[model samples]
Target: MDMRAPEQKYDPYRNYTRQQWSKLRDDMPMALNADEIAALRSMHDRLDLREVEEIYLPLSRLLSMYVGAHQRLYIAQRKFLHIEDRKMPYIIGVAGSVAVGKSTTARVLQALLARWSPKPKVDLVTTDGFLFPNAVLERNGIMQKKGFPESYDLPLLLQFLSDIKAGRTNVRAPVYSHLTYDIVPDRFVEIDQPDILIVEGVNVLQAGRLPRDGKAVPVVSDFFDFSVYIDADEPVLREWYVKRFLALRDTAFHDPRSYFNRYALLSDEEATATALAIWERTNLANLEDNILPTRPRATLILKKGADHVIENVALRRL
Candidate 1:
């Protein structure tokens, strides 16, 4: 008998494919019943039951397990330290391209997670809340780079998450205004101790690589209990961005209070062209340079098909 070395199999961080995902659906929890499904149905007109069942069902199930495990670990650590009763929020980071529907996913997860027995109240906070105000972006000459990591107040964001994860009470985050395209003055959202906090944004998983005299700063994913990256082909994302821009231009941009009021009058073709230009200049650039590279860092990866439905899910196995 010939003796040979055992071959090392590839260990992909994204471990699940479409077929394996179907198999996992049998064991995942069902948090949303018919009526709740009906409500979310109308809200997310783009998705249907099958997509939710196969994709989000498994994803939420994974998150629930993560939440439970984190709680157990917290308790165990505290007990070992001889501390009294305590709790910490399990932080989830959701990252994706601008119009890839990560915000909708975060909202849906928040609603579903809150319905769990003993109902752990889930708080959804977008990194948009940490975006520098328009005046500051303008001063820094980065108004066009709004979704880039540099556009946000990184220290403030890190401190806010540090507070939440450290179990701080009455922690408040600045509110952002889509209509005005800036951080609202004085307005804020106070997040008390919660079972889970989902933070969604474009560059949440991006590592800060600024040459700090000579070393790299800590990456954002360092704090995430679980992270998800929403993904789709570049062309599909471009089409969605253009479509969303046209829809928003026809609806929201026409309002007198709208910061994009000037774009309201663009003809369909012109609007599409402008949207493509913006994508080419800003969003696509950010996706290529910052967002896409961080995909491997996520614990879960939701891969959307050309039709904009989640066709596959990839889980990073333990």
Candidate 2:
């Protein structure tokens, strides 16, 4: 296979303006019912189903086409290389800064892809499952850098993807707990081969830090058929982070097992200050050093406005 960069021009900050994307809103296909949409909308401080339709529907369709292309490539490779009886899963990687809406993008894409009658069993997985337990991070004195690429079990993650790409079935991924902010020991989700597999996280597009000699395989993104990077201005993302933290303090953080339980008792002023502090010291630092550098590595870039809506879509022209 000739491995070269796609011929498409890369535009880092292009997006669909609200008005343009809104035109597709009314007729968008929805995998979730109204009640589920409403519930997810309530969970997000400033997002709703309409946004999903306008911004994400087109994205879903785009991914579906890529998925089809990937399958065709697999068939061609098997015929030409004489490697019969091999079926690699079509993998998509979604990367972005923290609180930049990559999670919502992954989930929405998962649901939309499943709505395709031809491939209605799409599976969604996140790199969160590869993150080491909180206790391990604390012991390694990197708890504050939890979202950094080194925070994950890279070897294990790579092996998992390797299995899937090798046409292995019944693979399992660790389960992560948002409330606890850690990997749940002994818990895992089994993934069956599907037409598509979506993996979303802060650093999915990053190259591996270790050499391939006994310590590391290739980066997980190398296995992806398509990749996306969700982007927004640094300041806007910081504000969103703080806002999300405040909102979570009122909800998820209040739960007894939440790793952020300490935030539940913070006064509004204190909570805001803490959120800003964490963003500055940790999240923002990781975004600049790790995540931002990987944006150009994506096949598509979804840029956002201050209002937290995608404003333009930049597709790498093939």
Candidate 3:
């Protein structure tokens, strides 16, 4: 068996190794301290100050530049059209497979961007809130496909984004609880005219499956000023997912309020078996069928190594 990794192919993106990408920071002082990085790190996520300095700091800086450019363009366009500057928030979409650390990326960017010059208000919203309610999923018989594209309230999500793009303030989004594993009834998150909004989810970049009639519909990525896709080897992602499941079982799953409380008393072997089964049956299938296919649509791709460290960055060429 010739067990070598497949040969790399030429791509539209300009690839930069980690070392090369880090240099782009160029004496820019690190915006975040160790404590902040620690706070931003999600459960079972392997993030540290070094990774922040090398990877996220540069990314934050790049995003800041993009935001600035976008603002200037917005102003120019408004002036050309003889209209007032409504100042829509810059939208950034972060997408990746389960347990790929995209939540950490979104949190880090939100924190770092808020600290930058002009210090724009930043908001982070996950598409989990846009998921169809449990009752709806049950009725549709897709309870097992919770993270798949069809499981989301796509129209509502699109409307929210449209309002944000139109500079509407106090837009309300539904709230979802991970502990309950469902959307909380009558609970909402209000986004009040943030300067930047980061939308994170497994399917943020996914395009809707086209119908036979060739009618066009706006997808989530259509609202993004910039998009990032976290990339990793499938085996590494599977390992991380399993590890996260185990960690949650020891912590959140023990709470009586948790939907997964039933798994809290499972033996380690049983827990591992359960986690593996869930991942293989749902998450892996979602990744292969939906998430991975949208990778090319991102403006930036942060490619992670087996160690959960971002080893390279591929930036889409202008």
Candidate 4:
């Protein structure tokens, strides 16, 4: 099946078919092996060696070049100002709909970037850690809107990025647990000065809302040097979401401590129905309202096919 996006006149992005994108890899060596791929692949996500070689390798090569260029620019600007060139992290935002394989994309990029020459320390952080605690959500009566933009601590997230971008060392971010489906109290992840920081989330690219006085608020994407959006047909994403929900029933959902333990006893049919309802009511609405609208803001977009293969890549022209 042809999975290419329909051609549009006056489009800003320069599109490439998968085969064309694979050619850009040229002499770049593959940094990942079969075992590593298996470890990086998220539950219910398909990411084989062939997909990595054809899609991620070229993408990683491109990112490495961007990082190098940014570093040189930093030095040049510092020299012009006659100041010390204090190195700052190159922040990359990975944004996409739920079940769109964005988490796997972030992990793969982190692994690949860490292996590159000069071996800059690369760190990965998700915006999940910035979500409001369960108690706050419940108090606000927005627990049902958990993934919505309002469910996050926007000011805190903005401050975290600001501190990192200001070259602050030893920044700490809250830790979140998917098993318990809530923020872990008193637990934090320390991010030392890293060469690259990958911030992945469903709302990373979302623009902040205007205030009552019409003053502009800073957005998380404003701090991102480069951003990526993972794209797939809606039906494909829904199918993956349902499959992942079912898979978790046998895995994480079976744990008595899991927030979703109630789903563990559901029959396959019942689970599918429940998953579809949740997706339609929550995830799909979030995608349409908050995520998909940010596609044009990305530096690059990875368009996946029904089989979870990236079939096209759209890179914004400089």
- lDDT per residue, candidate 3, 165-275, as tens digits? 888989999999999999999999999899999999999998777888888779999999999999999999999988889999999999999999999999889999999
Q: Report the lDDT tens digits of candidate 4 across residue range 1-318.
A: 556667634677999999999999877898889999999999888899999899888988998889889989999999999998468899999999999999999999998889898788999999999999999999999988888899999989998998888888899999999999999999999898888999999999987667899777799999999999999989999999999999999889999999999999999999999999999999999999889999999999999999989999999999
CA error at residue 307 for candidate 3, angstroms: 1.9
lDDT of 1 at 8: 50
Quick one: ranking by TM-score, best first?
4, 3, 1, 2
Q: Model 2 Cα RMSD, Å?
A: 4.8
Alpha-carbon deviation at 121 in model 3, angstroms = 0.8
C-alpha lDDT (0 to 100) for residue 201 of candidate 1: 92
* TM accuracy, model 2: 0.87
Candidate 2 vs 4: which has more lDDT: 4
**C-alpha root-mean-square deviation, each candidate:** 3.6, 4.8, 3.4, 3.7
lDDT of 1: 0.83
Pairs with steric clashes in candidate 1:
none
The total of clashing pairs for model 4 equals: 0
Candidate 1's C-alpha runs over 4 A off are 1-9, 27-29, 33-45, 210-216
